[model samples]
Target chain A: MSFPGLPRMTGWRPIATILILAGAVAATARFAFGLGATTNLSDAFPWGLWIGFDFLGIGLAASGFTIVAAVNLFHAKEYEPIVRPAILTAFIGYLLVVLVLIIDLGRPDHFWHPMVMWNPKSVMCEISWCLMLYTTVLSLEFAPIILEKFNIHAPIKWIHAISLPLMIFGVLLSTLHQSSFGSLYLIVPNRLHALWYTPLLPVLFFVSCIASGISMVILESLILSRGGRDYLPTPLRANLAKIIAVTLAVYTVVRLQDLLARGALRELTTLTYYSLAFYAELLIGFVIPFALLLVERIRTSRRGLYAASLMVVVGFAFNRMNTAITGLEQYPTQTYFPSLIEVFIMLGITAVGFSAFSFIVKHFPIFEGAAVAPGLHHTAVAAQANPGFLSPDGGDLEPS
Target chain B: MSQKKAMLIDVTLCVGCNACQGACKEENQLPPSDEKYLSLTAFTALSKYNDLYIRRMCQHCDVPTCVSVCPVGALTKMEAGPVAYDGEKCIGCRYCLQACPFHVPKYEWSSTQPRIQKCKFCASRLAQGRPPACAEACPTGATKFGDRDGLLAEAAGRISAEPTKFVPRIYGRDDVGGTSMLYISPVPFEQLGFDARLGKTPLPMLTMSALSKVPNVLSVGGVMLGGIWWITNRRSEVQAFEATEKKNRPSRHEDNP
Candidate 1:
């Protein structure tokens, strides 16, 4: 009953299993019945929890492009240890978004409509193309890791030949869509409240995702470190913290400047539901994380880094949720909370993601840089010719 | 692309009758429901502010934001004046529902095969040389249908004819780049729940301003990345080549000895 790739049905892993089962059932009921029966979405609020989750997932998964661009494109080879995990996370993150999209779509069957039907004018169209194309590039980037396990060298070499271009294209696609998520709301300037809506939303979104993306990488390393191994060295994690701190600082400055310029500062001074939510989001997502990371002691400490990254991720979610839901709540005059079915379905998809990540990591060379294939998994001896990429930064990548 | 028809809804003349709502439901073949606000079943709904009854329907902007934001081109601005919805083409991402400034588009969330439901300006009847069903059904002539230019002029004429009786502004004349539906009210349009601050520029222009920069990003970004990759990798290649040459070169001390 055991498979090499599947997680053992023990510990908290079983909860994920149960969730996966429940989520699949809920998904079936959703498609079988309708969004109204499953979700609290109405004419007043067409997008709800799922759309917010899409932003969160995409933002957090930003590590894949950022890391690859640094190592493969800029030749920053010192940070190659977490490359496989970052790529895998991005792959899972995107697929999860697509899954939620299918469940969220009124016509799951017509999800392909965007593929054949082109509307270049629409930001959504551009986002759809980028999502698909970037996923392909990620596959190429991560293919060698799996191919080496199976001892398949030909495609690995082919993939390596075009690796630089592939990584560049992936980064470009990521930049477009990550910002386009914010652009999606630009049309709703009237509908979205003054507190959240701004002409600089795209820039804000793009910058914030970089912070969250790096935080995600840091958080992943810390979380897995509990299993008795430092997923990333302290120096490396601190280096990443420095990046997050700088990104958050830029985000804070831009946001403040924009708010001041628009004369929306008065709205913040007034006590209202929206102002409170905005305050909370800024505090959790930006202010707190920025200040915490500024402390050299906290930045280098495992506990401090953990708290900071966790705050960044939470804050990232808060900002996106507030932007997507809370800010738009006033115009609609109707409150929306996801139904039990909706909540379960979202949880299940998340569980499935975790399960899939564990499964792939167990079988593939994700965390470890080894190309070992014990027992029957080893297919051929292409070790010398295998497209194992060395440091792109040359010798400057050595433990500095 | 054709005649460019428009509807002028004079709120002052409206008598709080729900006949237009009824007529819209009947024409679209939606289930009969006297909904208080816009819904899947009611394409046109009436909201009362004291004695004034306001009609809510698709503003059908000339540069419809919904049309511009639809990834599948499901919501389209027709050749005539109506903004049409093609259900078969709809992936039902609900971008139209989210983007509409008027909040006119409603979804069939209760149906498995949900499509956006909105007022289509009775496009079929317009093809048959008739006004929209709502315009035709209005008992007090509150809703008038005609060529867009003609309606603007007539609305202008009415405002000046009895400036004291009207707000003296056509609500949709310049708002959001001129919606197909025009409005003239006794009081301020905001009092009637109209978003007067939607700006004179079309909403699509906001997104387009960002999207327009995509080409520049690609070309400039591509060249810069390629150049960096070359320079960085070339330095590494040169360093490794020099290292090998140092190892292979004959020793000067051995030659002297």
Candidate 2:
């Protein structure tokens, strides 16, 4: 049966297909020739695009736990509609992170080593357990949609029963690991540039991730609405923007306070590349967005919200990259820029995530007005509610 | 049987001869190459600082950050003062590379089955009651190996005997909470390309301070979330009961009429 609301076969499909194919080729080459031949990674720079982007992807995915806790644990029923989409985004984001990790690992086959081998002192060990458990939690949280689509009743009840506990546990796990990403760099005070390194790195990372997480949800909601799925209400968008602004404000205060306390604020005044990058990160990523989001008019305006959120997403990516790469350039004589294969692989993984999301949203009960009860199936209910959902030949249901 | 072994390198007597590097390669059975930094093949290397030659290798820290940060316990600091690696236990995460203050661990990027590479302070040689290959090959007694306390005392004596000949400080004495290797140099340690800013506190303490709060966060967060859930659910239950009562009362009035 043809799925309703499946976007017509578009030019983007072929482009995505070609990128995936190229990515596959690049991945194969990476396996055959090894990291030295395919990427700019070396002993001087063991982590590159993969590690940096992993941080960003995971940070953005923080919305999954935030929204889930709001809806399920806190009983904020107004947020229930957005929970599924947030979880889906998180699931896809985590899947991509694991995929990139496997690609980047020296022995991807040994990825399961952390399960049996325990290192309680290791932050990496803790992160590994968190990633594994949280991914499973996300899948469980997302199971209801899949189960409802397939008219599975028994599992749906089980899922609903455990969801509350799952959400609490999930939030705990996300909070620990998200901040641990910053903790990973705490050991390199001498190597990491003073402009970025701080003892408060963990707190900074956690707070910034919350802002970025809310920003990502807002951006995704806007994209979905533009795609003809009005899943998010206007007031909800405004509220989300408000939350983003407040989180960013607090994050800014804490970050600057930490810098001042450490007496590393002087580094920011130096006429050097590190200082320039730091200023750019603070201004474009945090300062501008924070200022824009604080105004009621701008926070309510779709265009203004979009602009601020975009800045946040871009800025957060830069922050993570700087922490992982630029900050470590103090001693390395060989500068690092991701090779073409590395770039293509990253692009390809992104394309795959986007395509998978679109496909899942179309087939599953992702959007509101899409019934999520067992035996109530998506297409039948969607068709009855909106006749446009019944376009059999895959033509545009509404005027574009 | 012996006290924890340590290396005392007197940089003032060290020549630029690369016999130490060659000896390390021979002892480790690593392939020969002109790698400036430590690599999978070259566990120890020499860097020239002006007219002085400084040997670069793992510090084998007393409270090693690498040992603490390794998720699989692949890297461990032995009581014998050598940091040892078990390839079988390594998941190849390379977190040790990021955690090392000295940036000592190296990866085999060219190998499909990669393992972390670094100087283990000649752990095998220590077990056999011999000094490290580099220390054994040093002609000027620039690299000395013995009990860690003994080395520290000897380093202190040299600095006191010729107060103006060498720097008063012993590098790695308390840097990163002391290491198995110590250095006495005529010039400042920073001028010899050392990271002199590394605080005396062990690096692992930084992360442990953050991680120690995990239990508190989990327990407190769990109780808080549970309390919120209970309150919200209770409110909803009360609202539902009141609505049902109002509907029943209206139905009874209509029935009586």
Candidate 3:
């Protein structure tokens, strides 16, 4: 009755199972009783954690296009090793975003209305189309892996034939949508805090997502190496860190310049909650990471990369939250905080994503030279690849 | 039919009475609540700033940002005057709630199938050639209904005739690109809880500047990417051909023999 790629039932499995069950229950309640009963969302604050996390998920997934452009379009063959994993991450990230949207949407059943019913004037309509199209592109980009697993050489060739065009389209779509996320806020200049509101927000969002993407890739690679999976070469890792540092530096300059030009820097002088939030986002997310990654020794070192990348990710999350939630806290009488059910639902989604990623890595040819033989389940491959695999030290026994 | 209707609310004449509230509730058939802000049941609410009582509702702007941002065309500004809502068309994405500078649109959070709730400017009453329920119920001539241009002229006259008794500006004449609901206050409009910071430009114009460049980006980006693809792929193909040719050739000793 066990699934082919399912991991062994372990201590944490029970916890994940509990979270999934709890999430299902919460979803039922939300659907049955409506948003008022299950969520903290109100008339004043319509969007909350779901929208904010959608921004974060989309931002972190930016590496898919970045890596694809580097390897396929720019002819950076050295980056070929990370391409599959990056695409995989993006595919999962986008799927999770859709899931979050469905949960957050008041009419989840009518999610597809935007496809047939067009509103080109609205930035959200543009976002919906981009998300749909880019997801298709990601699927096309990732199709070769599955074809290779099945030993379907003909379709694999077809996939390779269309890959270049697909990557180009993907890059184009990602560029539009990533920037358009910021464009969504442009209409709310009066509501959004002056510290974050500017005409240059779209450009800032595009650049910051690039920095976040590079940092996320670095962080993921480090985690894989520590888990005894296929690790990226030190040279490639160093190169990525350098890219992160450069993008972060550029982002910092543009952001500060925009603030100064808009006279929004004055808002930062006051020690209010919003100003404090702004400083924390800037100093921790941009300045510290930029400084850390600039040093060769730190950028190359394991601890340094982990620390800097983690900071960038945290900062990116904070930025999205600030834009979507904290900045809109204009009325003192009305405030929003996600309910317990909402929190658990988010956790459940994250758990599912993490488990799915682990399962796919174990099953698929995500890592270099890790292809499984045709007609064999991934569990069989894993057992043959490493005997005595039940022990705690089994992962360590695998070749690095 | 030739003239667009408008509401001119003279705050100087308002006495903070609940008649408008009672009338609105009865006309809308909404449940009773003491909510301080607009909600699903309360299409309009009154907020007090010191002795001044201001009625908060949809401004129904000349260039309504909500109608522009509603991906489903659920909200629209009718030519007659009111900004109308079609519940059948609403997917409830709530972009209207966010895009509204006045923060007027309220959600039906309690309903399984929720719709955005706001003042539609009494489209039904207008169709019947009658004033809105609130305007009809007003004991004082505070809330008046008439042609938009005529109302503007009247508002202008009142402000000029008693400059010392009124603020120098018509609140909605140019705020957020001019709303259909006009206001004239004795003290400053800001003191009556109006957002003085709202710019004169229509909010949708801000997003339009960025969205308009989408076509150019797609075409230019497509060409640039195609060029890179061709150049890079061609070089790799040539290198591969050279490598295969090298392998096919005999070794030096074999060739000499």
DockQ: which candidate is best?
1
Lowest lDDT 10-mer window, candidate 1 chain B?
B244-253
Docking class of 1: medium
| Model 2 steric clash pairs | none
CAPRI quality of model 2: acceptable
lDDT of candidate 2 over A119-168, digit per residue (tens): 89888888888999999999887888887778887987776667667778
lDDT (CA) per prediction? 0.85, 0.84, 0.83
lDDT by residue (B201-242, candidate 1, tens digit) is: 999999999999898877788888878877766665555555
* Residue-level lDDT tens digits of model 3 in A1-400: 2233333446767888888888888888889999988999876788898899899999999999998888777767667777877888899999999898988888888888888888788998899899999999888777778877788889666666566667788999999999999999999988888888889888999999998998888888887776554357887888898998899999899999989998888988789888988888988899999999989998879889899999999998888898899898874556678999898888888778777777777767786553321111233334434433334564423242
- Expressed as tens digits, the lDDT of each residue in B190-243 for candidate 2 is 898887788899999888888898898899989898788778765655555455
State every prediction's TM-score relative to the real structure: 0.92, 0.92, 0.90
Candidate 1 chain A: 10-residue stretch with minimal lDDT: A372-381
TM-score of chain A of each: 0.90, 0.90, 0.88
Candidate 3 DockQ vs. native: 0.36
Q: Which residue pairs collide, candidate 1?
A: none
